[model samples]
Target: MATSGRREVARRILRLTDGIEESHEVHEPVFDIKDTPIESLENAVNPLVPFLPDIRKHAVTAKKACKNPPPDGLTLDESASIRLYSMEWVPHDKCLYVVLNDTLRSEDGEKVKPWFLYLKLFRTAFERLPKQHLTELENYQRAVDIGMHSLPSNHPNFQQWKKALESAKEN
Candidate 1:
């Protein structure tokens, strides 16, 4: 994998695991114009193409994690499948928090664990978002636009989330 790809995978893993006792070496961003031409950069940074590989890896890992029975000797229901229940956008974080239905349960009928999926809004596959989510994004952007324009310059909330939203939208 390219350095960017590796970084993306590491990022997803860290997010999923909440960085519990995890450490990753940080590397300076590289922009090798010579090695990676401008066209390649354009393609690499394309929102649709940039995150497919990372998302695929995440899907596979999540599948395996959910499919296997828990170590506590609990058996998963054969008919159970992970299902997305709802998604909420966190404008401050520039990410979507996906809540999923329980896909596994103990033999005693207790829920095993709940899965939380985080999808970073910037530099990611927007197609992963449902039409309703896209509408939510539009609604949020409109609300921010209105707030930025209507709020007084010196108001504490003025331009608070505008900058972050603009930055994320750029990606």
Candidate 2:
């Protein structure tokens, strides 16, 4: 994946999960990613394979994208799959995310069946990713959680940010 594509995936993962431990999307009757077979990224998007008569070139572009994985430790092919999912071809509405998200949003569970293998691969890549850590905002939230239970309500530093704001207003 290119630098921009990896950055986008990182940003989306953080935005989607934020303080949550895991990011998830599930349909009715539950298609477990664990049960789905893991496959090469090219094979995973088999429906989009433009090998024979199909004319979609973006699929080929995605397949031809960098095979190296990002720092997250996903396979080279898995990274390619992520890149594919994020790419936009000439027609903005025809993007893979557009179609995949539509399938995800569908009321009918049957629509999602075709995407099982890709979903498994995508979720596997996600599993390898680190979440909501090290950044200043997440650091602050973590600090708050650490003391939130131990501090007494009457303590000077208890909800100290609120007190500090009120003090500033009076001054």
Candidate 1 global lDDT: 0.32
Model 1: per-residue Cα lDDT over 14-76, one tens digit each: 343332232333334322122322222112223322323243333333335544553322222
Q: What is the TM-score of each candidate against the true structure?
A: 0.21, 0.53
Q: Tell me the whole-model lDDT of each prediction, alpha carbons only.
A: 0.32, 0.58
Specify the highest-lDDT model's number. 2
TM-score of 2: 0.53
lDDT (tens digit, per residue) of candidate 2 on 1-171: 699898776555433333232223333653555678898765677754332222235556766775554555667766667677777554444567767765665556767777787788877865554443224434654556454555466644444554644453444
Q: Identify the runs in model 2 with alpha carbons over 4 angstroms from their true place.
A: 1-30, 48-60, 67-69, 131-171
In the order shown, what is each candidate's alpha-carbon RMSD?
Answer: 19.7, 13.3
- What 10-residue stretch in candidate 1 is worst by lDDT? 77-86
| Best prediction by TM-score | 2
Candidate 2 has an lDDT of 0.58
